[model samples]
Target: MKFNWGNQHKPNLFTLLFLYFLIVLIVPLGLFSAYYALAGNTNQERYLMRQAMNMTTGDASTVAQALESYRHKAYQLSTNPLVVEILKADSLEAESSQSRKLYELLFTVMHGDIYLASANLVSNSGKVRVSTHVFPEVDDLRYHGNDWDMASIINQNSQVSPTASLISIQSHRIAENGRQVVASILRRVYDQEGTNLGYLVVDMYADALSPQVNSDHVLTDMLLVDTKSFYATSLVHPERFGSFDRFPALNTLDGNYTPRSLPSDTSIIAISPIRGTGLHLVGSLSSAPFFQSMENWLSAFSTTMIIGVVLALGLSYLFSRSIARPIKNLAKRMREVEQGKLESREVSSAISEFSQLEHSFNVMIKQIISLLDLTREEQAKLSEAERKALESQMNPHFLFNTLNTIKALARLHGEEDIYTITVKLGKLLRSSIDNRESEATLEQSMALIESYLTIQKLRFADKLTTEVYLDPSCKHIKTPKLIIQPLVENAIIHGLEPKVGSWNLSVRVERAGERISITVGDDGVGFPPDRLPDNLDELANSPHVGVYNVYRRLFLKYGRKLHFSLKSKEGEGTWATISFPDEEAIKEEMQ
Candidate 1:
């Protein structure tokens, strides 16, 4: 008998040489090509992100410059002898002719901003000497102490360098048009000792500030946010308002551009704060195009390497059949392990080294699977315990007392209406207690809102009217149940219940691309921005707990895709907006 090696045959050398050549030569070249492409693409992406951020910063600076120029012009108007004479006289009656001439001169010379709908000379004693546009009637402009209150200026005891300040210009033009108006100004008049006597109010039409702005695309959209509510005036589209947050890009008070959103994607945001004011100009650009090109090139290189490996293996098979067969079996076992099958595959190779390796891998896989199962069980138990603890935190007795009050009112008034309210309340309580799903369809949420609103309408009777707008596309999308009802309830009890007017509670749902937006607004004495809660925890601790509750649930379900915000001006009304991801995106997130 012929002497037999491990393979029961002698192996040929040519095939092995080819395999070695492919691995050593072709694979190294492929790796180098991949590295070069990725490096070039990454550099390009960095350049693009930088470019966009620079554009936003530049646009913001332009707006700041324009306002600064306007303020300087107003200061120039403030210095005219005629203006000082009118202000010093105290009462217009003392120098009415001079005051009139002074007003006319200032208006003609300094009405430079296209957005400056009107200019005024306001006295501390509640006198508006002049106005550009007369509304309802020109003489109708009478000073009320409230209208003359200039909270925008830090009333110094003496004159100082002029700066642009936010103020309300008393002009009928904006008031009659039902558009909001706020002034960014040049200067305030002062006495010899620098005491503030009056202000040279340069009123800007909020709507007119972006001449091209329309309801659909307000300029407020492109704003970068900071501690204060100022935005990048130039980056904003003419119609989109409050659509972008400067909070992420730049600090309105401190100009900085730090990197944000990377690894998965890279982009840079730059913010430039106005020198003295709480305004930030922000800009952003994505490095996606550059990165995508790099990914494609890298993938092509990987594919070529895989092809070369296959060709080398084909050439080597005959010469290294015993070694190659055992290696191929090992690869198949690894694929099964990777797929989580974690089971032994048949290994009939006669090679002792290969047989030992296969047995060892099988034993390790079994041990890992056993440990993974135990970990999953422990995690499940912990999650269950946490849920039970949180569920017990809600106070049931407090709800009982509030319900008793409803029954007492119904009996005392002899009204059947309270019976209907009690029924709705019971259903609401039941839904809140029992709904177990992390999220529910918008239609289900809307029903919950309707029930809550119905109860509110009966309780307030003549004091409230509720309107609901559900976008046609968003009805079947998923969001946490009870998310909207609490906000509506808060609006009614806190916003409308105390006000005397014909209160209007409006709830609107909208779908935009991948987002589902909900708005709740009320025509009642709005909460002051200063008085609003600072964070979710503060909101929960205060009377606005309902708003906080909705906020918390949103965070729990959607993370960053859910957003909550409030807009308020006292005596005007309050508007609250909430946004969530659309249905398809929400489902993908759940998976």
Candidate 2:
């Protein structure tokens, strides 16, 4: 028996075609299928989050409705005229033991829970006539200590109207134990002519409110934080009192709704404010499940991808021996090219598709070499052009002599102001022309504005008062040099100088994220409504030279990301806004 290399060398076209179909079509289709699978999983996760948010919001609405219901019932019981008449009768006199009669009647009629701990009547003379809860002592009936506080509260609440009303956290004494419970809603009992008789207090219990948050199990911990004392009604035990400054839920706090990290290793929080009460209800839950779902999805996708890649490799090998041999030869040739040996190697195959691939490879190698030579020539041309542009701009000696001659001529005329102005102008122009850099720190721009204002002040005199406000954090921020001066010049010459009263010129710099804005405003007669341009081209036109120049410079520096806005009213004031992207924005341009 002998091995035959001649039989192995034979090529088949159909097998080569099948393997090519698998590489070019089937493999890409598999990748596309995987991408859509991942996308579907992502959408599913988002949908689940949305459903959770909706459920949480629904629970919040239910709680609010319950509180409203409690408030309405309390209001109805508090303002009943019969209740008021009895309390007023008790206040009038002892009246043959009639006070005791009225007390018993009141207790009998308004007895039982009614979802409240107790409902009671109190008189203006600081007496608790009757209460559903028993009195611990005679002083409890007196209620003398709470009269001033409760009366003041009743007097100030004007929103409480003719029928019934709610007071915000009424301070009341529960005479039985003198344990003060903060009441949420109260009603004033009045006479027929609306004279102050007494008040009916509906006592809601601290423990009774527990049912308001029945879905606490859904979240890790649910809490109610009152803005008044920053106290919690239902927080994790032992740490429920005082401000929740250190609570894990506070980490999730944002402008209103925030996410906070919990001490428990696996929790995340979502917090939102309760309306009217100014209390915040925070819900903390574990994110491990959400993350685990994502991980499992990815793991499944990775398994699928591995299966697909293995099937593709096996199919490429199994379909045709002739196609596999040519591919192996092509890979060897690629390795030769990678090793800096680009001399083309011939591939022998009777299969048409494999033969075509061999021909294409030879053509591609020749084209790549041609492109390399062309790229070298283009690089040389770009270098020469840059060098010539640099050389054409140099004439420092002639520039200095010309500046000196101008200074001499201005001084000879005895125009001291003009001479001083020319000197500063020359220095400014020289720095601007020589620096050529696109960016400068805010300090440099501030110095430029100060110098420009000095010259402008000499011309405008007492007509103008200038103000500059810059955020301390923006001191190191880089901006275009002389950017602010152009805006100030526009405000002074066109907006302020022509007006009467105080010609106020204010410049402000505000930094936010990867953007900075400089605003220059003036309390001057503003632009006529019809004269303002309708589009950006008009804003950057020659008619508004100073504004236009700055606009153009900002456009060159930051492109579409640099925003410009102008607002002016007929007689009130004018504002010119210049906004540009920061360093982070510059990096985005590269990408």
Candidate 3:
């Protein structure tokens, strides 16, 4: 009701209200706008980059698995009985018969993968003996022409070996499907006597090794790089195959492709190698779209600020005191939060808006604390899993050599029993090799144990007798692998093998009130009480390394809940028992 609008000398309510609005809203909004225009974009880009890299990691694993599947196919081709018989054929009748069988086998392998264009058993003499694709007929023989210069490619490969295969970066005609197969996986097949019978030539389509990356990304380029020859083939663009000249940023053609910089427009580049093979996946994401998104964001910010300013121009005089105090209080609390003071709580105001803001802030703090605790637990679980994995590893080469020897001996002596034992040994070795998880069902652990004991019983003949018993109720209970196997192994190796006469070993798994108990005992020589290990550290230095590993893994997994007892007396017997609560019991305890 006052007439202050005409006077410029006296302090007016409009001017004071406008000053308050500028102090309370416009200054802070200006800072917020500047941060959004600059630092916010930088942080968002980094976050997006991290997300893209995570996706790249997953796609890399998929590509690695695909390449591994190809390697397995090559192994199957090498070990096929028909492949050897074809090399040993003495007459045209036998050769033709074996060739048909070889063709069928190749077709079976090729048909499983849609991208496999052809699979062939190529002779050392450059003859395409058998092929999955239709071989052109030249007079009476199949196509003998080096249509893809297959002969020169074979001889030029210096890294083809019994253990290592060579991948060539060359285009092959896919006559059947009319699609181009730009690369070949060539593996040298050799007999047990080290005789090079022939090699397997598997031609795959250009996109066979391509990781089906997210379409959100601008481009994904695949390079098939031979692990031995350092040959790289670009799958996305065929003309750039086998050379890094087109990619000047990467200085070398080697598998270790660490590029200093890629194309200028690429915001991020992720490089993942197809393990155990000659392929590397290179993913390029462009920055153009990110810039476009920021442009839209800026436009939205400008519109929002314009609306806020217009509303403030009209409403400042009415509610300046009501809005400014609550906002300042919230700002103070936020600053405390920024300084790591999560306990600071602001009192609710008489205004509903400020009261609601206070309530939401408190709820957000509680959620943050809850998430931190959950993250810590997950991180701990991950560490334990990694430890379990490290403990399960062994020198795979030793396992392979031992199995190959057993297979060779079984073939030479024509012993079905030895072959059966060899097969069981393979199962045991595979179980140990393939245990990537931290825990297994009680039944799976028992199966691995039975396989081990079966092999032992076959080896010891009349000298070993082993019994394994499991309560029917405990089959589905979760237990870590290597928990029972090492104990069983110790019972057999240290308990029975050194015994002079026939010895007996027994394994019993039964459920106690709220826990599962596993006992492995043997009627064999026992360690002297004085020589026994007192704790985990001493156990590591003792002869029972397997026992040490089991104890360490269990203690790390179950913490204080693990119950282990190792008792033995000289000339009596050795018995080791481990008991721990099952998953349900543990969950109840946690709750």
Compare the candidates by TM-score and give the number of the best one.
Answer: 3
Q: Write the candidate numbers in order of decreasing TM-score.
A: 3, 2, 1
- Summed backbone clashes in each candidate are 11, 4, 0
Write candidate 2's Cα lDDT for 478-568 as tens digits: 7666777878878887887678777888988888777788899999889776777766677654577767777777778778888898889
Q: Go through the candidates in order and give the C-alpha RMSD of each one to the true structure.
A: 44.1, 32.7, 43.5
Return the candidate ranking by lDDT, descending: 3, 2, 1
RMSD of 1: 44.1
> What's the true lDDT of residue 293 in model 3?
89
Error of 3 at 122 (Å): 1.2
Residue 361 lDDT in model 1? Answer: 82
Candidate closest to the true structure, highest lDDT? 3
Residue 415, candidate 3: C-alpha displacement in angstroms: 99
lDDT of each: 0.62, 0.63, 0.69
Predicted candidate 1 versus true structure: per-residue lDDT over 1-591, tens digit per residue: 232367536444445655665576566766777677657666665665465555555555665665566566667767677777677776666366775676568667755543444556666664645555532222222433245332233232122454334432222133344544433453667777777666665545554444322223311234423333333333244222332352343333233334221222344444455554445544444445556776787788778867876776675555466676777778667866776677865565688888888888877887898889999999999999999878875665567577778878887898778767876787788677774676777787888888888877776687677789888788788776778887787777777878886999899999877788899898888878898666666776676667788888788877876678888889878889987777586677889
- lDDT by residue (1-591, candidate 3, tens digit) is 223456557754546666877678777777899988879777766765565456556666776676667767877897787776565442224356665676677778767674544676665553446666653221112243445344233544565555686655543444356665666666777776778767676666656754354534345454444444444566556556555555642343233564222333445555666566555566555656777888899899889998988777667756766666777677668778777778746587988988998889988988888888999999999999999867655567677778879888998899878887888888787777774787888898999888888887777887888789999989988766778998888877787777788898899999988898999999989889877766756888777788888998888877889989898887778999999878686678889
Regions of model 3 farther than 4 Å from truth: 1-14, 90-96, 135-153, 170-177, 215-242, 248-263, 318-591
